[model samples]
Target: MTESDLTSNFPQQSGLPGEKRTDELGMRILKAAQTMFVRDGVDAVSMHKVAKTVGIGQGTLYRRYPNKGSLCMSLMQTKFDCFAEAINEYLRDAANATVFERLSRVVSSLIRFSENDLDWLKAILQSGTLKDAKANIFESPPFLFIRDTVQRLLEEAAAKRELVPLDPAFASVLITSSMTPELMFYLFDSGYTPERIAERYVETFLAPLFAGAGRI
Candidate 1:
């Protein structure tokens, strides 16, 4: 799907106090952060720098986002919302598409989004504040959404005898784990293009699950 298609599906929220103003400020902060992140490396874009760039006080920034990790989470939430919408739309309109085709599209879309915003993704994943000892990455909204969606798709494919009999839950975990942010970055840095990575992943990992259904 196009970037415009993904963005146009982002949900419009309301009901909170000063919701409009809050969203406005949040957008301003994200824009300032994105600019700094692109000009400098993610490591160099401090919360102080972001606040100063947006012409806001440190306290005001902290009130909205207690740390860089919080800001990054907000940024990721926006991207994930768009992503989830894209997946839903594809599933709705592509009823005639094979389960493997639908699954491949989801994987391609995710990889493209990551490559397009690698810097922000790296920053978010590496942020010190996000390193909570008790936190489960699988429990995060984005991860859960992806895992559940993939599992559902795999289950449907298996039901139709399009895929070999297997545990959808385990397969979904395997798929998502292979596409973690760190692994994707490493592959990119090691001279693998996103398209090549996606192709290889489907060939080596997903294609085999289809038994004799052939390559994706």
Candidate 2:
């Protein structure tokens, strides 16, 4: 199926009481799966293992997520949504300032989030990087969601004359590629202060992006 068709199938529902319950259950299942995948490998973590970790029967896991692909897709989507919500919330509540101020706040929040989820993210990123892997996890809805969000903001910034007129797609890739938590983990493994990494990140990537654009 096409991307639009695929996206149409994953509806967002959470406000209703029933949806809230499902949301809670989904989160529990996702966390269990994440733990298992991190401790073991993605291929090693089965629906049965996730069910066992969540203290539920295999039937329940199957009922919720019929297959491995579906489970992984849902798990990534849920986790990414939650992560993005946190950043969006921080941006919304930030003190009155320019959009640049809000972006700075969100970027710092992202750094903190990466540090908070470092272990699991590190493991997953390393394992998921294998070229032989069957599933292209990065091509899933979750990644697309984040990419789109970043792209939208880039487009908005350009339209408002806060940033130069560049292709939103390339800007999205640049932002995400530069700030990816896994990159920071790699940098640390190679020996660099996270503080320095973050500082240079803004100075190098972000500062240049805005330099050529007119301010709103």
Best by lDDT: 1
lDDT (Cα atoms) of all candidates against the true structure: 0.80, 0.64
Error of 1 at 167 (Å): 1.1
Tens digits of per-residue lDDT for model 2 on 1-216? Answer: 222333333445569898788877776777667667656866777677788888888888888876666666564554556667666676567535666556655566566556655554544555443334336545755456656767866776777788866798887766765665557678777877656676767777666777786453
lDDT for residue 146 in candidate 2, whole number 0-100 = 58
Regions more than 4 Å wrong, model 1: 1-24, 34-45, 213-216
- In TM-score terms, candidate 1 sits at 0.83
Per-candidate TM-scores read 0.83, 0.59
Alpha carbon deviation, residue 28, candidate 1 (Å): 3.8
**lDDT of each residue in 1-216, candidate 1, tens digit only:** 343443444455565779877877777887677567667877788999999999999999999887787787776677778778778998899989989988988888888878987877777666665578226877888788888889999999988888877899998988886788888889999999999988888778878998575535
What clash count goes with each model?
0, 0
